[model samples]
Target: MTVPFYMCCQYVDGKFCFVLHEWCAKLPLKVQHHVVHPAHTFFLLPKIPSKFFGVFNCNICKLPSNGFAYGCTMCGIYVDINCAFIPKEITHDAHPNHLLSKVKPLVKLTKRNCKACNYPMRFRWGYDCTSCDFYIHLDCALFLPRVTKHKCDEHTLSLRYEPAENHISEYFCEVCEDEFSPWKWFYHCTRCAQSMHTTCVPLILQCEKSRMTYDSGGVYNFLNVKFGGTLEIKGHSHHLTFVQGLESDGRCIKRRYVLELSMIFKCLEFALMDQIDHFDHHHPPSLVHLQQPSNKSEEDDDEDEEKDEDADNFVEEEHHGGKCNMCNEQIWSFHLSYYHCESCL
Candidate 1:
């Protein structure tokens, strides 16, 4: 059988390997000139025979390549299409001042860590700077797109190649609910405050997009019927009761029960605005209230705890000139009634 020109394999190390013929022909003149392997130039191989081929691996990525490879016949160096197409030099938003050049690490330091992902550099191909200690993995530098859309969120997420200085706190992926490494690339949606890992993007995209209905009457009915019961939210010690039609005083409530109810109402309002649909088919929306402890012993214990706390505060005020615990500011006579800092509270 006569093989098509695009399907023709190149002989290397007495073995045939596959390569994308069209991809090689479309390479820019600048990339073609900068040969990756020093001893010999690499050529595209159309296909690798299924049988009698010893284990062949790409020298750049150190991964096995069976199809579509760029290889050198004399030096016996091979690389997959993705690794072979790495640009000679790249200007990333993370490092704008100087362009990062693609270079192989010294044989002695073959296991240096990548600065971009903080992962060990097992791959032979990477972008780095000779002047500085900046080094990034080949996959990290080239695998992501600037903007991408996923069904998990409504807003388009932009890829953040580098960590922002202001984002010091650890970030979690909205899709996987796993902690994200600051050194690795992640997608962020500013409007929704959503961040996700590149690996989780495909899984999120596969999920069915949630469609919400915004009829006020329907929402009212849903809230009243389906979600009226008490809910146990994670992290909160108390059970919350969803309340309906509570009037807001337009100011923060000081009472604990009132405050909890107010917060739940605010969340419901926000959900209404966003037109979020509840998964429970049987329940309706309602207001949340904290269930009071029924046991008299527990209530007495609470009173004792409050008295002890008040006694400690009295001692602290006498010794420390009634300083605000949060801000460490001296309390004035007029403000002595308020124990907490107004802003902190």
Candidate 2:
């Protein structure tokens, strides 16, 4: 079952999908100085800018935003309206002059670690500095509220990015009683002399409204978005919006939390897929898949196959409605994110 709201923001279609809350729907169209990408202005969008990815995730918190999101359409960078306030440039005492830029790693590293937390960053969306070798997880770079409250402390706990000046050789979390990296950020209460790991901090939600909604009898949790309807493009008569991805998706968008390792894997898979059509000129020929609606007849398919010998190269399909060749598991491609290479085809 889904909760109801008085008003909500949907997408390009005039009808409501019940995703964005009323206040969040009213966010600014663009901002010049957000920390998520200080170098560029982000335009508030009804949906993600491109269709190369089956999912659209915020570069800041690295969570999927299926509704109203602010994005740099030119750079293909996006963020949830929920995380639009965090800054791109921060000055942390732990890593002073913390100027971070959103980055997508080129290849998979078996065991990579964040420069700040000494925690694994493999398959993660993270920030990096070009001037230096500094690398920090997007999760670590943000979500550490500057101040918080917990059961153990009477006073508000302040986040300390660096080791305290009067700290001993080693420190431990007062809440979990486990040792954590001093080089990473932690919450501390000065009056109570209490310390806590960033992960140990309980989620303190600011509002009852979550990024979910109800419509009809089923509960709809909007995660990553896949294109559905068609839009008329100027100077073009036929439909340009895609249908293969949408039909394969079957309208199932899975519910996911940010802390899961599967989230990072999904992020990485989409980042790789995005490279296929990152720019207008550099876009692969496969983009032609979207030029026509997916409801093609057998004659149309045979005709298309006759036109190009390399036509199959465009889809990179493993097997439609079958087990993935790489992971060897049943996959609902649209549920999270998946990479299907042509090797198994």
Winner by TM-score? 1
Give candidate 1's whole-model lDDT.
0.52
Candidate 2's C-alpha runs over 4 A off are 1-25, 28-60, 64-79, 82-93, 108-112, 120-122, 130-132, 165-170, 203-345
The per-prediction CA RMSD against the true structure, in angstroms, equals 22.5, 18.5
C-alpha TM-score for every candidate: 0.44, 0.38
For 258-337, candidate 2 gives per-residue lDDT tens digits of 32112121111222233242122232422112233478899998887776544433333334445543335554423344
Report lDDT per candidate.
Answer: 0.52, 0.53
Q: Residue 154: error of model 2 in Å? A: 1.8
Error of 2 at 247 (Å): 37
Worst 10 residues of 2 by lDDT: 211-220
- The residue pairs in collision within model 2 are 35-87, 35-88
Question: What TM-score, to 2 decimals, does candidate 1 have?
Answer: 0.44
